[model samples]
Target: MVSINDNFHCNGAYVAGDRTIKCWRYPRSHGSETFVQGVQNSCNPVFMAVAERLGADRFYDYMVKFGFTEKTGVDLNGEAVGIIHKKENIGPVELATMSFGQSFQITPLQLLRAASAVVNGGYLITPHFAVKTVDENGNTAKVFEYEKGEQVISEETSAIMRDILESVVSEGTGNKTYIPGYKIGGKTATSEKLPRRSGKYIASFMSFAPADEPQVMCLVLIDEPKGVYYGGTVAGPVMKELLSNILPYMGIERDAEGTEEIFTLMPDVNGMNLKDAEKILKQNGLDVQIRGQGETVYGQFPPADEKINAGTKAIIYIK
Candidate 1:
């Protein structure tokens, strides 16, 4: 197991071969801190040190094992396999840059899939849109299954990663994505586009919910966003907004103590038959307050996509 407390000094710059890698906190040293602290700080030198320890061979092997060297075999066509330095061509500078996720290119999906393995009990899963097809009446028509590839890391290691990543959201650079009463694990990145010093970047944040037992993962990438382009600052809020609405819609209950608060999205019941609307509201664990005696719903309070606690009363206007 990799030591979370491995000591590293980040004086904001690391030199490898002819290249100089600088941390985001360049010109201001973080002095010395544990590996865990380095992750929290998003310190570049810590990762460069770790890469040095792993060496080129093992690091390149991990890149291949994580499906970085090939397409993820997704159902979609025209999927591209990202670029990675050839094993023999990876020198000290290459390894250092790659350690902090530069030097090579990877699709957002590829990064998500690899990140998933680190917290998903170490299983590499194929991402797909549908698990099964349903008939018009909602009867299961056919089932589709994707491969759960080999375990890349031990469950114990996955657990540790989960804890560390959770800290990233709760107390680190990804703090902007944190929501009260929910466990979140995430990483933030600001990737510089090609042409080196080009003033362009893709700010991104990758997150998963219920850090101890993840049920959903999200990757938000903002391409060449204007002003304040750091991932934690720009993309973190977007990720937070997304998960805030999505988690409750998916019926994932909040983990607050002394309370079991479950939430669901408000369905658009306007234009639905009164009885049908009532049924749908009831199914979503909402109590209905019908206004005016009529056969069809004309309006609804707490409108569609709003997150409401389960058993909450929904006011539906009829006509």
Candidate 2:
């Protein structure tokens, strides 16, 4: 989250129409990251450190204010309140994962519910895909009767938070989600749920921007991306592609003037070495990771073929 906010700090929310309805419960903190830094980096450790201060009960209170415990009651059936165990019972690992958006399972609606509060004017909103529903032999009514959730955080907090979110897309974990000149903010997350042998991963990216007011927000989830599965790798790129096309279609103007500079990127070096090819890649704005303490480069992802913005995750099969 720190990573994302840093990039977005350059652009905040854009205002839109009033919430479907108003009245509400809604919903961060200290560190080297500063508010925007923590958000831009999506620093789970930082967010967890803050959540610890907020404590389990306070965190749960924020959850409640966001309406996580209640059913959203959208027009369609099948909706579930996400699971949140007793704060006292929640352990460090569990809390850490939740802080970074893992461990707990939430229906898409539940996820959006929390996100609504984060970017939707400091108020949680019940979402609906349909514009309106026709009444029984009469007029059409708005599909969602927006009941304001709660004001969990201060407006000042919300404003800074929006700026922080923008940093995510601008220069953080969510850089892949940037759309030329538009301001974007949100998070990208990856989960390790299966055995290592299975070699599968879940990558997800979520964003809301034009921070003055958000006209569009989206989340992309890939269950088991076969190649380069981190959210920053698989999901972030996909979100960027979609946003680049959709933002304009939605008539959302770019905050900055258009750009023509195209970046010529270098290769990925995830499981590479401090020496050899890994060093070469780093010279071009790329980064590296090794499996063992061993210094030799091994296999790598993005496999020296795909064209992408530099710094895309490329895990190596280290020696």
Candidate 3:
């Protein structure tokens, strides 16, 4: 892993189309970022450098170690085993591309199984559709047996990875999927389909919540989405919605308080004192920003009763 972050000039060493291979740091123009930031931002070049160092042999070994080379051995029948490239076909370029999760193909089920091991302390788990079996008379018959597979990654490595993944949600590309009260750690992937499939895209986000104590893992994938097919934009919203509903139903207590409410309507702050307006906005989970220097509020952008999502900023003008 990168111990530090700095500028990395690709210089067309690994070119795709007309542009040099590099990470696109969105919203910001240009600067250096930390290693954790790279993971949070889903920086490709940062991972590509690591892949180049690992080379084909070690990289392939890690893939096998993650159970990517074989079936997940789930209880469901007809489970699809993902495909990995042959050893001979894994060149430097292929390895670099695969490092950021491209080129090779894997099923959502396979990914979930591997990801579970990564967060569950390195033990490859068999996903089951049924927890317990029922008899014809609605009596309990048998509970599903679970086998703890060998550790694919070390405990220390898993902990580090969990921390890094958590940053992805809290500080990185997956920030859009973050829920206020939950500690979510995840990665977003935007995979391009082959030309044979008419160059479509699959936007995906995979996450586990309460990083220190993971209760559940979820994956959301949108195939061939129209307009803005980014994992953080499309699939991230879906995962956020699912987690928002399911986490509470599971009776998992939130890590933070006062996060259960959803703010859809912007409250009227006009004609009220600045302090009172700010207080009301805070109560509704909106951040207050003031324009002009007066104490009494004059106007507010988004106005009154406008539809807005939670976590949106409210700008109030005071006279």
Candidate 4:
């Protein structure tokens, strides 16, 4: 088990060989913080230091074990095996950059699979679409199964990671995705596109609901968002919107008490005046997103009578 009290210092940047790796919160030093705090803060120096302790060989081994260097063998064609630095070529700088997810490439599915293993008791599961085929009268015709690979981490370690990740949604950068009465765990990412300093980024958020025992997982990536491109800002809300609808449909009841969110049925605003539609939606505790410049609302999304969490954005189209 990892020690929560293990301390790491972040003095804006970490020096590795001839390179200096700066924290995302550059110029603002976090003098010292425990491992949990470091994770909550998304402090780069803490991860860099941890990678230093693991050394290149051990770190690379973990990467390989996590299925980073190979294709996941998913039930899809033309799946790409992502790139990673060769063990021998990984110097101090390379290790540091890779420690916090850089200097390498992996598909979104690959990352999701690895994340599943981390939270689902460490068993690497093969992802597939079909579960079973049915015959004419809805009778089962054939069953399909996928492999669950060897355990890559101890159950105890997996539990710890789950708790840490849960806190990430509750109190860290991922807090934007948290929904009341639902236990959610997630991580936000803002990946710089190739040809560094190009002012382009992919904002993404990976999340699982009912964090204590995940039933559904989602990975949302917003490619080159127009503005406010931080993952938490751009993708977290999308994940929240998705899970709000999905969890209940899956029959997963909210387990917590005293903090249930207020949900409302979307109202029909079609053919209504824009001001009247806005007033009606606001009365229902919903927000509005107009799609056109016209004053009359010709259409509405979540169209009418659909139940959604309060504060959800209702889109209205005009002609």
Q: lDDT per prediction?
A: 0.90, 0.64, 0.79, 0.87
- Candidate 4 lDDT, tens digit per residue, 1-319? 2387898889999999799989888888877988887887778899899999999999999898889998888889999989999999999999999988888999998999899989998988878889999999999999997777978988888888888889988998898898877889988888888988788889999998778898889999999988788888899999999998999899987654612355567899899999999999989888788898888999998879897778898999987
The best-first sequence of candidates by lDDT reads 1, 4, 3, 2
For candidate 1, give the lDDT of residue 295: 98
> What is residue 142's positional error in candidate 3, in angstroms?
3.7
Every model's TM-score: 0.80, 0.64, 0.74, 0.81
lDDT tens per residue, model 3, 1-319: 3454444433223453344554544433224456676677677777777777678898998888888888888777787778899988887777877888988988888898889889888988877778788999999999977778889888877888899899889888898888876788899988888863476899999999778778899999999989897898889889989988888898976653423344468999889999999999988878778999989999997889886656688999988
Q: Give the per-residue Cα lDDT of candidate 3 at 313.
A: 87
Q: Write the per-residue lDDT of candidate 1 for residues 1-319, one digit (tens) a residue.
A: 2598878899889987798889888989788999888888888988898998899999999998888998877779898879999999999999999999998999888999899999999987777888899999999999997677889988998999999999999999999998878899999998888988888999999999889999999999999989888999999999999998998798986675412345567899989999999999999899789899889899998899897878888999998
Comparison by TM-score, 2 against 3, better one: 3
Off by over 4 Å in 1: 257-319
Better structure of 3 and 4 per TM-score: 4
Candidate 4 ranges beyond 4 A from true positions:
256-319
Judge candidate 3 at residue 122 and give its lDDT: 92
**Could you tell which candidate, 1 or 3, scores higher by TM-score?**
1
Q: Number of backbone collisions per candidate, in order?
A: 0, 50, 0, 0
